[model samples]
Target: MTAHIEQAPLVRRVFWRLAPTRLFADLISKSWMESVIPFVLFVGIFTYLYIANPAFGTIGNLQSISASFSEFAFPAIAVGLTLISGGIDLSVGAIFALVDFAVLFMIGVWGLPTWLAILLAIALGGVIGAINGFLIGFMKTRPVLTTLVALIIYRSIFNLITLNYSEELAVIYIEDPTWNFIATGRILGAPVSAATLVIFAVVAHVILRNTKLGWRVAAVGSSKKAARHAGINYPLVLFLTYCGAGMVTALGAIFYAARLGSVAGPTGQGLEIQALSAVVVGGISLAGGRGTVARAVLGAAIVFLIQNGLTNIGLPGYFTAGILGFVVILAVGADIRWEKNKGKAIEKTLVNPIVFSFASTPDTSPGSQSPLALNDRLKDAEGLAVGLIEGPEDVVVDRLGRIYTGERQGRIIRFSPPYFNEREVFARIGGRPLGLVFDKDENLIVCVAGMGLFQVDQQGKVEKLTDRTTRNWLSILDNSRLRMADDLDIAPDGKIYFSDATDRFDLHDWTYDSLEGRGNGRLCVYDPATKKTRTISHGLNFANGICLAHDGRSVFVAETWAARVRRYWLEGPKKGKLEVFLDNLAGVPDNINRASDGTYWMAFAGMRSPMYDISMRHPGVRLRMLKQLPRDEWLFPSMNHGCLVKFDESGRILESYWDKKAEKHPMLTSMREHKGYLYLGGLENNRIGRIQLPDADQNWTAHDSYWGKS
Candidate 1:
């Protein structure tokens, strides 16, 4: 076991000890942080009301608040929809009043059935919305100006109709069961309107977050020019958005009419202002394209609670409005400040380095007798596809002896045998492909750095096998999405085992993960029969390479940053167990692959340096260095040297290869032994290296070893 050093200053060392709670910092970096302020305020206000006024906690009062909140939340959501679409609907209040008046008039004067009246009322609101949509979307009119005029016209029409029918409607009462139920019935212990709002909120949230139409709406709102360039119908999306907003507003009107059974001139007079304040306070951006239905509902709840709670506490109505307005102003100011500083906040706190110490490692001096001693064995190795490829991180050989490697440009390059001069593009899979392997079907399975596990057929048709695994329930960030799949190998049962390098950073920012030095990696498996992926192990430190063992009962995994190889048993008595196979390596291991001699060949992508080793023991110092210095000046492993080593199953190093001059193959990431020849690949080099293995088996191939000759 490795020992940790405790030589730092007391205060700094004690402060660094709290680094594990960086998970909370990770949570703070997510988009949900935008809702934090409003949610906290809501909770504080509710707690104060519940303690200050016993009546506020009463079941009757709670039910009343729920119903009222539901009635108001619909308008808030409607206004939010328009705002999210880069537009505004100032006519929501007028539409609400008009719909309410129409519903009551139909039920009382026209003698229409309750169901028919509700449908007609909703349609009326939709028609008004359609009008606003047409004028603003198709007519190229300013949304604020168009909706303001609409509000005026619709409100005037409501006033005129109510003036003619108010007295008559005041005397008429509809004795309808459905209307009564809508007004006061409860479902599963909540008001019907409240229950319906919950369902609608969930659906709207899903639509905004997970659907294509929602994406289009957000795109248009974010940038109309960009959306148009992306072939989106901006006008149609806007029109549909406004139309949907109107229908949602009408839902609120239906519940309001049902509860009151009356309509008046001032029924929905200031509703538009209230809804605008609610959504903005709830964290919806007035500039558009950045809000959720849940936030809208939460805003409505906060506003309603303040309004009702103040009145119940004997505060005057005007004073209540004043306080609500003050809250809205504060919320808007806070939102702007958060938008400006959130990125900086995350940068300052995201990389929480922990104290990580290493045991003594093997020496690789030039004249040392150790098996891992430096040498010039790979200095004269032949280069294949020189200058024709970039960053071939891993190399694989097929049954036909064709050489395959992944390029930094996101294409697989295949070099024909014999002179190895002819080259062709094998596949154009995006993302930096890190590890390559072939299954029993001869299909190439790859681990892409940014993408997830993918398979390429014989014809080079790419198919995504899986990109996500079952999520951890307690994780703050969504761990389901695979962030950086690094290496993979296929099991005999056809299950694909892989390593996700890091959960916190992508390929480009991998250096940051190394600086943090946390266990942010995991081992996952994809079962083709179930079409599902699941995480098998968690808390791996930069899990990189994977290779199924010769016995087929275990697999070797390279924990790159930890400089160790671990064997995970897959069958027999030790199934579902992990044991360290090689420890305290001279360099950071990258990829592990099978050797023709039944041992394993592993590449050391970078050698461990004394400064980096010292820094690991002092995480506080590392954290300070990360925050105070530029990235290029940070202390890290030395990737300037290339090295490879062969190890037997007994955990003894047999021999080592090195490019001591760092000329031909620096930064070796993988090595494959095929037909008595060892092929090398590097993540930072421009070519593939080949050296003849004189004493090795001359006829063995990885293809035949995994799946017998055809």
Candidate 2:
């Protein structure tokens, strides 16, 4: 008891000493600090300014500084939208200039009404946006390239219409009173332009935060492939988003025209840098699929402050570009550095509790049996796999009806049904086996958590095929190499579909995986012919199970963290489409199977627990873990109880079953219903169990291990 008393205060002191300020000081001492990178150059600028002149901090100057958000606010908004959607827009400056000149021509030379000219200019923005969207969205062109074209096109046109024409001296005058009010008038002591910018932000926030459109837009940005599976129209949503962005740029162009009282090549010129800087510095990720409008505003304000402050303090004009460039690089660098530092903090938070739990006699063993019993109708589940895998997640059958299972240590054991007795080590691919599927030509595909993809032949030979897709296009942050490749399915042509469950954290760090929406989970595909791996989608909380459609036209993926199923269309007008197949799931989906009856059997790896729900609802738990714990021992929800649910191709819940006590099993990972019997596999279990199903096919026998047996 005295020992406990002494240790408690020691623990308390240790915790207290790790507080923010102290750690920050320690962080600075590390030779590197995240905040230092971006602020390095900016800090120098601010210091030079303050030291050079004390009045720079005055309220009047600050207000004037903030007021200038008007010029580049719209461009920031554009970049933010693309960033949130998980892409970049490099052509914003050229587009802004183009829109500015078009409005000038329409109103001054065409003699159109100011409102009409603005409308036409905005329409032109949309037109330019449509071009960008079509190239990137439909053609699947790289964003940098497509936008580069738009950028060049718009800039060239701006030059031809304004610079070249002005040399001959073209005239387009701005004379509309309402347009002038919008550009110059003040309301509530703030620039009407600023107010308008706020309104733009609010509208964007609503779309991104309040509605399904926002979710879809974000989904597309995170993973175009995953979004397609979720039934999200990639092109349509992205096209619409880009078009809207174009409209926003047009608004900026109008503000420029109104502010300058004319349209010229220089209008809206060289502003993309500021806009991109604002969005990025505000914390919009360069990789996409995660950002907020409020952040955009914050970013814009900072950019405006810097630009205004530097000019006011007598900095050279050339320094503005250099300063902006430095800030942009710093922002990205700082974000990464911050996250790295943040990861260490999170590790502490996550691990300390678990450590404390251990110190307090943590239950390292499997959890106790559930008190509640389930009245389940899914009695037999054997019809799904027909005995491919037998022991806890033992066997996984591919398209060729071949069964592959893992043994005590690392050997991949293959089995067949007719004899159904002698299971031999077909492959020696290491790591514990989790899920499996078949490609078009009957090649076996396996998901080995720490190991990644494995393959086998007809003669019981094994090969370590791939740990991840090798392509220059993806950036997985260290977590990209399939920490836990739980389950997989194949598309019609031969694309290997799988999930990378926790990119920031690995399989063992599953708890921290749930805490932060770090977006490490990803849906990826490997092309056998091309051997190229691409992250079709990312930002998933924890993507798990997978199963392709019988029609060979659509693929379904399970996001365990999101508690939902999503479908991706492989062909037709809706190709590259994604939609939520099911939502608010009762449990985290594990492995999925397509039943003979045309429905899909989704294995609920664990039932819903209020504890898990609460934890998920508050992301701070994860953030705190990031702030405190190490990578491994963070607090996370346990997936101990098992449940199986039936869903049709349309994602409608057909029926469900559960084993609450975990008596027959603990932590069920996959369930295959074959021949009136259900065979189950658990991630951490000793045996496979069977139950008789009332309506399953009687003759549905296990597949012969003819393929993947080399």
List the candidate 2 regions with Cα displacement exceeding 4 Å: 1-67, 163-175, 337-345, 354-710
- Where model 1 places Cα greater than 4 Å from the true spot, the runs are 1-17
Pick out the ten consecutive residues of candidate 2 with the lowest summed lDDT.
Answer: 354-363
What's the TM-score of every candidate structure?
A: 0.96, 0.48
TM-score of 1: 0.96
lDDT of 1 by residue, 1-710 (tens): 24433355666655665655576677777778788888998998899889889889888888888987898999999999999999999999999999998998899889999999999998888889989998888887999999999999999998998888768888988888899999989998888999999999999999998999899988988888999999999899989899889999999999999888888778899999999999999999988888889899989989988998988999999999999999999989988887788778787877888767777666788889989888999888999988888889999999898989998889988999887787799999999988899999889999888889889999999999998987877668888989999998888899999999998788888988887777788899999999999998878889998999998899889998888889888999989998888888889999999888899999999999888888887877788898789988988888979799999989898999998988878789998999999999998888899999998899999988887777
lDDT, candidates in the order shown? 0.89, 0.67
lDDT of 2 by residue, 1-710 (tens): 00121133455434543435433433543322423433444556667677878898666665455445665788788878987887778788988888777777667667788878888889988888888888788888898878877787778877776755673334444567887787668777777777788787888888788799999988998898999999999998878888888888888778777777665556556676678888888777777787777677667767776777778777887897687778778789967676558756543543222111101211112333321225433333223223434444645554334446675466776655644455656777767677765554556677887888777665655666668753323441234466777778766566688887765455555665555434457788878788777777776657888777777687788877666788877888888878777776666777888665667778777665555455444444545756666755544445666777778866667666666455555567777656666666776665555567768776554232212223
Please report the TM-score between candidate 2 and the true structure. Answer: 0.48
